[model samples]
Target: MNKVKLLNISIDNISQAEFFEKCKSGVVFTPNVDHLMKLQSDPEFVNTYKDATYKLCDSKILFFISRFLGTPIKEKISGSDLFPAFYQYHKDNEDIKIFLLGARVGVALKAQEKINAQVGRTMIVGAHSPSFGFEKNEEECAKIIELINQSGATVLAVGVGAPKQENFISKYKDQFTNIKIFLAIGATIDFEAGNIKRAPKWISEIGMEWLYRLLAEPKRLWKRYLVHGPSFFWLILKQKLNFYVDPFNSDYSEPYKGVTREEMG
Candidate 1:
């Protein structure tokens, strides 16, 4: 498999169609600019990423950067796009039962309803909007795990945002005996639930989705886009100049080195 290395992380170089064919079961984490920045400082987030079955490219900015690095990614497979495609691809498969975990109180339920309606069947078998800071509470996490197991879901898609969602999956993925596929999809649940509007296709295609989102929720997303996002380019430059360093490992200097789950262990 081909990989596009940006700075400290490597993104899988795969198209949406290829992803659908290859990824039958396993944890999928889509890495964007925000995720990349988070990985720079957060050892926990980096560890969580190391456990991911698929580290997919979720940002057009990252895609463009890969080109600048001379290893162009095949496609950008953002979580918001991947979720709809995933259900649509498995629409006829009765075995693809999905349980959504994220968003506000009624948001996951709304997303479940909308998705099932579009798929013409109950593709989403269960949905839960976990309380804020639910990841910190052991009892709450265990209860949620039991709930998902009881729902008979084969796929679990969590859209709680960033390292939180990724860390949750990394810590408790094995506890889900019935779940075959796990997706760390940030904000997709809210988009599906109609609680938030996604950027238009044209804006997304033009690689201005971040700008659109920043404008949409200025107060909430300003730091992610304005503050942390620009550092991605500087990191990319470091990689290009062969001066990039992994924060966790001082001796390592490779830019395009990909780390699999086994490699991490």
Candidate 2:
């Protein structure tokens, strides 16, 4: 699929329906402004996104910017939007097993319980909550991988946060031969588990979800939205003025592939 370059990140121009239909067993990411900015100085993150099977735009802010830049993305397919929809789509398709990884202690288990009560519980094959630095521990990573294999899950949703979740999936996705779908959903699990409240529909519709989030957890998110958020505009301005260098060649953004399916293994 052809992707447009906003900040050197290839944002796929796909709609909600097309993205869901494209979903399968592979590393899928929903890149927002924070994620795209991180890709600038972080080569590991850049490499992770480069190999991603699906790069869905999660930020409404990015959507507006894309349109302003004359490279409009069809719609936003964020982790929160995609996660519930994925389960709802497979509500009757019990063959689609799912594994919930990441989140604070007991969060995944509680999320599984809530989802099970709402949808069918049988599809949630396994859930785990790794320690803060569990990824750094070889034995811990081994156990986590083993648990996923034992669960026989086809879909894996990693809600451990941005670059960490992305790096984890990129590092170990090939190890899960039976796995199909991987989502680097930031805090969707916490939202599902009722630990955090989402913004009202109207707020989200108008593209102020970030503001709502900043209000919800001011201490934690202040730096993310308040500090790092403002810098994104300068990058966009640079791109618009034909000054920003797209490492993958600026020509790749043309012939926009508005919608396409993921190549599932």
Candidate 3:
């Protein structure tokens, strides 16, 4: 597996077709500007990323950044796109049962219903909508884990935002003895349930999805896009110039650790 380095993280330089063919079992995390920005300051999130089996480029902006860095990523595999494709690809595979966790109180169930209808089968076997700050409650997490295990789901797709989703998966992944694939997919459940509409394909292709999302939920996403997002460009520039330093460790400045050839299998 070839990976491209960005700041302190490595993104798999794989296309969607390649991802489908090779992704048998592992944790999948889609990294975007917001995620990268958070990674700079969030040590736990950075550590959690080390546990990721597939650090996929989830933003067109990242694609452009990779190109600018002279190590272009093969594709931008957003969780929103990947989740649907994954279910469709495995629609006929009886053993590929998926459990969707996240979204609002009823949204995961709606996504489950819609996805099953689209696939013409119940590929999403279980759906859970955890309460606000549910990850903090050990009892709730235990119950959720138990529910997923009882559902016989082989895959777990968690759509809670950012570090919480990743952190939850990292902490409790070992508990789910039956789960093979873990996807930390943010807002995908909302898209599937039609609770939120994605940006137009052209907008996404042209790298304006951030603007589209900012416009859609300005109050919620303004800080992510308008405030924290600009820092990512600056950081990318620093990385390009070999001047970027990991905030967690002032001595670490080696951002050009490119093409990590790992035995993912």
Best prediction by lDDT: 3
Worst 10 residues of 3 by lDDT: 256-265
lDDT of 2 by residue, 1-265 (tens): 6576687766889887887677655678999988977877787888888778889889889989998888888888888988898888888887788899988899899999988878856878789999999888989998999999999988888998878999999999888868888888889999889888889878877789999999888998899898788888887887777666544443454432322223210
Worst 10 residues of 2 by lDDT: 256-265
- Higher-scoring candidate on TM-score, 1 or 2: 1
Clashes of each: 0, 3, 0
Ranking by lDDT: 3, 1, 2
Which stretches in model 2 have alpha-carbon errors above 4 Å?
Answer: 246-265
- Give the range where candidate 1 is weakest over 10 consecutive residues by summed lDDT: 253-262
**Candidate 1 root-mean-square deviation in Å:** 2.4
Query: Residue 164's C-alpha lDDT in candidate 1?
Result: 92
Model 1 C-alpha lDDT per residue in residues 170-254, reported as the tens digit of each score: 9999899899899999999999889999999999988899999999999999999988877877888877877777787655445
* Model 1 ranges off by over 4 Å: 253-265
